[model samples]
Target: MGINDDASAGQAPHADALAAGNVLNALPPGYRLQEYSLDGVLGYGGFGITYLATDHNLKCNLAIKEYLPSDQAVRDGTFSLRPKSPGAAEIFHWGLSRFIEEARALATFNHPHIVRVLRFFESNNTAYMVMELIGGQPFGEWVKRKRPLSEADLLAVVRPILDGLAMIHASGFVHRDIKPGNIHMRTDTDPCLLDFGAARKLVSGKGGELTAIVTPGYAALEQYHSHGHQGPWTDLYSLAAVMYGVITGQRPIEAPARARNDPLPKAVAVGDRAIYSEVLLRAIDWGLAPAEEERPRSVQAFLQALPRADLMQPSSLPPATVRADSHSGFGTLDTALTTQLEAALARHLGPMASVLVRRHSKEHTTLGPLRAALANDIESETSRRTFLERTEGLLRGESPSRPPTTVPGSRAPVSRPPTAPPTTVPPMFDPQFLAAVEAELANHLGPLAAVLVRKSAAKARDRAELFLLLSDHIANTDQRRAFIRKSVAAFKDKG
Candidate 1:
């Protein structure tokens, strides 16, 4: 879950007493769960509690979400959650199963824009989900500090989220909640879509409908009723409402009010035309339509309706003098060199490497500044240093230590010098084993796992060597050990 801003709102009478009671129910600091230690409560809501925790095995921070469902359940003297009433037990258990299902489904997604679920387990008569702890402010708070953002800046945030949501929709899920507080903005990586507690699979008829969970001013009209028709258009409405809030500094009129014939101002009319493009504003209006039928039907349709040319333009770079290298000129850099650099950087970053390269290339005609700029985006110091060393060799016109691989989205591989053939060709591992490794690695590294696994498999001589090579990509000592142990066990079972 992303950082929640207001957990205390909508509390029943005896709010203070309820808060203190809930604290007693929460896990105390230093309490251990497998490899993780509870540090403190990050936030709580009607559904569950999210705790800040340290992964003792991985030696990093993470979040643990416990299924309490405060409205229908409570912690007893033994600290195990039981239904508040005998009648509620069935509903409570049903919700618990849904929570577990959600964790399993989320674990399979390797999208950078979606919050990554690391592990899930059943415990204490309920269930728990361990997720990557995001280190950034909520998009709601970010907008508070940096309102009146340029159209380009807003698209930078919105485009990645739409891409992630599109993936979720294609996988048969709908993020029922898409408020500003649920979007996390990271300094080093792309913004992430968070708080999937309200997410549900796209099922037909009444059997598929679950209890309605909504955020006011952001939710679509269909979300107000349990049996109302909902799909991709439902989420798009909430996202457009978020955009309306970002541009006009206030959330649009809540959907129910608009459904009652109350006026909701158009985004185009409210926003400054000079600062924001009419196409973008009108697209937002189209998304904010009270009737789901009136809204853009899909993410692709919504994206097509928005301004596109500006999104492709590189973000402006800080002014710097061009370096003295003859290859450094005032115009675009050499196409071949750019391709080589993108391919090298992609090994460290993922597919986003090309976008980052293009974003910086317009201003950085010189190799030195461009490399430095790209390195800054990398979060790990070790990875950044390694990237610099590799690119430094490339910029100096030196032959790579190994053969160049193909860059994603490119038609051909980066050209390499001829070399003597090796005495032995590395044997290929079973396809099933490779897929298992990729899935396991994705638990830790998200979307980058596939790329890392493919590269490591190419160089590894055997199953053991392959696991060892892939383990290097994981920074945590205990996690690497765990990954290797699990992979070996899996390989032995297959054999």
Candidate 2:
């Protein structure tokens, strides 16, 4: 019997309501597949359509993934699945069986972060994998709706995902595709790794053995070549790309283009290193290294390179190792030196000033470089003098007056009423003001700076409004004031 001409297809009287001319070729809502009723199309991709479904016997919601490779098949006016060309049938069935095998393999997994497959079956000349209908936002949309994830938040989300990847790797499979869209964030912020359609048996140096599918920006260069040695490092690159996207709000350039002429900037160089730990940024850069051997060989090693929990605690805690070589000309400093430097800088800059100072020390090992970097993040001349004096004292082995009790991004109790929003609207015609805003924003946010400045400028009614909107981008109070001071000067110079 032709797959589409099955008796089950004819019995679903209300199936047409859901399937009514949907281009994805998904069975309409109310269409029965075994004991489950399709509710609607939850999502569709190049390889399949995920349908929100109800298991009538169990009376529970599920997501059903129907394998329909778009390039090789089409649904005609009669809603029948057919190969685009007669010659494609042999290849189609081979892929169809592989899809079924993928479902079977995933059905054995029970990890929290890995999407669970309940069962697999054949229908409509294709395969379907039934999964629990997970409730959460995709990582792509999560990043859009929420604020940029700090290094701690990023690690919290990705660590569990790496745990899940470890299981898949142990099962002797490579999840060839891992990207923002394939990751879902639960309401409580736990992450689930989704999509295994690109997964293949862990085989190396074999051409045409694995499916040639990849998400461009997230795919490693090896995945591009059929004979490329695919291994754990393949997923490692994509996972790092996903984390890179979370912090920077943009994917690294595609691996192919990068192989030819890599214009990709190191994560530390992309933005203010203070906003994110140098360790986290460098780890991401290492994960995204073009060559597979250069990338982290294992998930555990990658996770180890990230900032630890202790680093995110109150500033009074012992200093966590911060790599200073790339960010500042100085090599890595011992924890004591770091603590002393932070303590001295905090004295002059503010409670949160240590973050900015530490970041400055990374990019500027010498006093001159340190002063230049600090000049952009510090505003008052007196404060600047105090900073210099404190540095001089620290260099001379003087003790820090007192350590900051609070972390840079931590909130303090609100004892006083919030300040009123500025009412005086400034003219919108100042180019210098906008340029200054972008420049300051780029210091922390990297390439996303221009995009954010434009977004803030659009909502701004006046110069005061613009300042208020952009100020939130800078996490450190000292840096915010410095940005405002410089931007205000731009308007004055124009006058």
Candidate 3:
């Protein structure tokens, strides 16, 4: 849409008009503000009015953000900016100085995905920031026009934004407010990060007053408290929230509410697993964690958590062969031994293991063929070994030496406490031992390596079974030796 000079025509009335009127204090058409001429209003944000203007000298369109804190200031009939009350003038000028500082700081950077500040100057007793007018709909509007985005499309838009965010963070500033509304999608599909006013306060540390401006569902929990320690991870939280919105066509539950009760469903938990990879979905969930430390510490770490496009193609999507047959209703394996095998496989394959085991059971009922198929599904030799070690005896009808005592994904000891009655106790699962296995496994397989340990540990009846399980998942002799040494240390710790 072309910019218009009419104050009421372009900007929507603010929802809280009494507190902050939605009207843009548009300068009259042809009115000159130094090198630029007023053209129309772009939009109103909590801190400023972004106006469409013509750069007279440059002969191009520009977006000028007017430092008009609607709550503290107002425009008279002649369009002169003034504080609402005598007591509010100090706060208004303070914010004005921050707005100019934001413009000056942004002018020094030149990144493709970041907004470019062209100039900044005082106009009508207020500060104005002139930026190159970006061409594209706001990301929120784009999402509405395009309901659901593909994995490729989502990554294409987000990666560049992350790259830009990384640079911003490297400069020692955080984009505390990162939401769909501030993300602009160019016609070429490049995403442009917008609105540095909120971030500017944080960067400049002006007046030591917290910005307190936040968009619910996008702001990290720590942001709610002024004194809370916020860093680069805060932006990562909002970025993940934006991804969640893109995938589900819905905003996640607000962060404050999530702390009391995390009612918001994960991207995978909400039926997005079919379209998105578990790694990507998990990364999104990980980034969205309420606690700051629980989230990815940096943009690079978050990027690493995402599966590469090439790897995602082959391993992220569940294999087509695992689908259940509608007519026979026998697509899954459920024999007690097979059940145990499926549990083991699920640690590696995520939710797909159940389907795969059942399909393999129907096609390769015999142990020999079934074992071969299972091995083919596993990517690591160590993981394959673990699978065989657990199932070999089960397939041969050998009774387990002891009852299973370990819980999947937990390292807590399964053995009874020394103070407890011995009769009620099963066996113990040593947290130290499981922790060593997970740490060693993670070096080779990333975070999911722990899954291999948890699944294997859960089925072990004794130390022998546990050793067999660990050996199966760690094929390298030196790595196996290292694990053994760590286990020995753990055993000593328990003793």
Q: Pick the candidate with the highest lDDT.
A: 1
Off-target runs (Cα >4 Å) in candidate 2 are 1-22, 76-80, 204-208, 315-495
Give the Cα-based TM-score of candidate 1 against the true structure: 0.60
Q: Candidate 2 residues 303-403, lDDT tens each?
A: 55555454364542334454444433445444555555544454444333334444445345444455455555556688766666656544444553444
Give candidate 3's TM-score.
0.60
Question: Which tens-of-lDDT digit does each residue in 1-495 have in candidate 3?
Answer: 111111221122122111123355656556788888766566666677777777878788777778777778888876789999988898788778767776788778889998887778887888887777777666766666665566766777788998999888888778787887678777536888876756643445543345555677788988886566677889999899888887877777778898866888977677376678665777788899898888777787676556554334544343546545443233443355555555555454433344345445645645556656666666568877776676566555553233334435322222321112224334677787678667765654456456556766786554434544454434333554454444433432221
Cα lDDT computed for each candidate against the true fold: 0.70, 0.64, 0.64
Model 1 alpha-carbon drift over 4 Å, by segment: 1-25, 311-495
Candidate 3 error regions (>4 Å): 1-24, 144-147, 201-208, 314-437, 440-495
Root-mean-square deviation of Cα positions for candidate 2 versus the true structure, in angstroms: 16.6
Alpha carbon lDDT at 89, candidate 1: 92
Sort every candidate by TM-score, greatest first. Answer: 3, 1, 2
Model 3 global lDDT (CA atoms, 0 to 1)? 0.64
TM-score for candidate 2, please give it: 0.58
